[model samples]
Target: MRLDKFLKVSRLIKRRTLAKEVADQGRITINGTVAKASSILKEGDELAIQFGTKVVTVKVESLKETAKKEEANNLYSVVKEERVTAE
Candidate 1:
């Protein structure tokens, strides 16, 4: 599935458009490499997202075209979450 779609369907981002913007700005990476909004994602892929002062990392567990609130968390597993301190 597309990175932007996965982000929204998984509830990682509030909306697909926001996710696309974030990806386009280079704030997201897949498997340690920067990814675009249209990046292809597969199960077991790792995603690192830079969100303002914090960075969130998650591993893709599954892909769903649509997920309910309770099912969203099943799409990915949170690997790490850290706050970035500006130098």
Candidate 2:
């Protein structure tokens, strides 16, 4: 699955375009390395998304082309979420 697609399908981001924009701006990483919007995702891969001042980390659990709102959370497991304080 593509990073942007997964983010949208999983409901992490509201839309795929926004996810791509975020990835293009280098606001996302896969397994500790910065990833692009087209980055490939697989089961067990970890994703760290920088949203404003917070960094949300999640592990890919499942991939679905389309999922209902209630099934979105099943696509990934949130490992951690931290707020980065500006210095």
Candidate 3:
């Protein structure tokens, strides 16, 4: 699945366009490298997303074209989530 679609389908970013914009701005990384909206998402891949001062990391668990709200969280597992500490 495309990274943007996966993000939306998994309920990570809430919208595909937002996800694409985030990806285009280099706010999304896959396996520690910057990734684009069209990047392929696969099981076990690590995704790190920067949302303002907060960082969210998740591992892809499954990919689906569509998922119900109740099943959205099952698509990925949160590995790490932290706010950037002020120096």
Candidate 4:
């Protein structure tokens, strides 16, 4: 699955366009490497997303074309959520 699509379908960013913008700005990484909006994602991949003053890390659990609200959370497992304290 594409990173942007997974982000939206998983309810991470609210919209695909927003996800794409975020990815394009280099606010997202896959497996500790910077990733683009069109990046390919697979099961078990770890993603770190920068949102405001925090970073959220999630593990890809599954991929689907579409998911209901109740099922969206099952697509990825949040591994960590930490505030990005400025040094």
TM-score of 2: 0.97
TM-score (C-alpha) between model 4 and the true structure: 0.97
- The CA lDDT of each predicted structure is 0.98, 0.96, 0.96, 0.97
Model 3, TM vs. native = 0.95
Worst 10 residues of 3 by lDDT: 78-87
- What lDDT score is found at residue 5 in candidate 2? 97
Any runs in candidate 3 off by more than 4 Å, and if so which? 85-87
- Residue-level lDDT of model 3, residues 1-87, one tens digit each, is 999999999999999999999999999999999999999988999999999999999999999999999999999999999998756
**For residues 18-73, could you state the per-residue lDDT of candidate 4 as single tens digits?**
99999999999999999999999999999999999999999999999899999999
Q: Candidate 2 on 31-59: residue-level lDDT in tens?
A: 99999999999999999999999999999
Q: What TM-score, to 2 decimals, does candidate 1 have?
A: 0.97
Clashing pairs in 3: none
Q: How do the predictions measure up, each by TM-score?
A: 0.97, 0.97, 0.95, 0.97
lDDT score, candidate 3, position 64 = 93
> Which pairs clash inside model 1?
none
Model 2 residue 59 distance off true place after TM-score fit, in angstroms: 0.4
